[model samples]
Target: MNTTTSPTSTKNLVDTAAANGSFKTFGKAIERAGMSDTLRGAGPFTIFAPTDAAFDKMPAGQLENLFKPENKEELVSLLNYHVVSGRKLVADIGKWEVAKTVNGQSAPIKLADDKVRIDGALVTSADIGSTNGVLHGIDKVNIPTKQ
Candidate 1:
């Protein structure tokens, strides 16, 4: 598990996800949640990004339904579960049993045998750098327990 990925990309978290290609669904979710500007803004944030394949695992039409304007609140809550307040490296995150997210909920963090898991999503890639923060690619979308 290579956690501390070294990079100097000038793009923000949103742009970094866009360039990753695999994060199309996560990127769109961010936009739909109206968080593109927040993620693009200055100051460090850590994002547990879910890959498009992860979104595919959702119940059929669930993703599309979440995109509807009426459900934006739900979408925002879900997306915010993946975002932390400040930039956190894998080791830093590992110290947190449950990390406080921007959405007011805490995501459970697990580090075992050198692998990292957040809210039941396995981190496939770690420590991707962006201008404002770092991102880790997850194998699943992390839904809050309440939802």
Candidate 2:
């Protein structure tokens, strides 16, 4: 079986995720949200990236709906909800009960049976470091609560 490993170098977040191959769906969503430039820009970000399988698990038609041009705002909001402004490793995440996302909302972190969960999604892979951030792979897609 192929295992996903974190990029150790200072590669940018977008490039790192693309190189990993596990984040193709997410990469597309990032582009659709017009967030490529932002994610590739300065300061560190902690992204809880959902794998392709995670996106697949979304209710049928939901992902398609979110991709619609008119739903851009919603898609962007959902994507932003998965990102925190600072680079946070697994250890740092363990120290917090809630992490504030770039979207201006808080994502609750839960520790149970030695597993870390964010917004009800399981953190399947942790601490994938990048040039501008770190990424954790989640098993399920996390949708931001409607404002």
Candidate 3:
């Protein structure tokens, strides 16, 4: 998987994630949740996006259910939980005790031994720069409330 994106790339966050090919399921989720335009828009945003393998770690049937039209709001909330308002690279994120997600909930940030965990999901790759913001690849999907 491509871990770092060129800081000079003109592509926006959505496009950068798409180009990496590690975020297929996440890309679909963003599109299905109707958050594509926002993530692609101007102004910077920080994303702790789960890799496709991370989506595979979800409970059976839950991933499928999240994509249903009736569950759009839930999907949106879940997706929003992976994002913050500013461009926080790993270094910037490490300085914060907690991050306020787009979902309006705070996610605990833990940094130790040169590794970072956001809301319990370990960051596999970080500081992938893009035109709109940065994207960090995470190992698991983080639920708003631990379940």
- Per-prediction TM-score to the true structure, in the order listed: 0.94, 0.92, 0.94
Model 2 C-alpha lDDT per residue in residues 58-124, reported as the tens digit of each score: 9999989999999999999999999998888877787789989899999999987777889999888
CA lDDT, every prediction? 0.89, 0.87, 0.91
Candidate 3 C-alpha error for residue 1, in Å: 12
Candidate 1 residues 34-95, lDDT tens each?
A: 99998999968999999999999999999999999999999999998888988888878877
Q: Give the true-structure RMSD of model 3.
A: 2.0
Write one digit per residue (lDDT tens) for candidate 3, span 2-112: 455578989998998999899999999999999999999995999999999999999999989999999999999999999999888787787888999999999999988
Looking at model 1, the pairs that clash are none
- Candidate 1 TM-score over all chains jointly: 0.94
Q: Once model 1 is optimally superposed onto the true structure by TM-score, how far is the C-alpha of residue 106 displaced, in angstroms?
A: 0.9
TM-score, cand. 3 vs. native = 0.94
Between candidates 1 and 3, name the one with more favorable lDDT: 3
Judged by whole-model lDDT over C-alpha atoms, candidate 2 comes out at 0.87
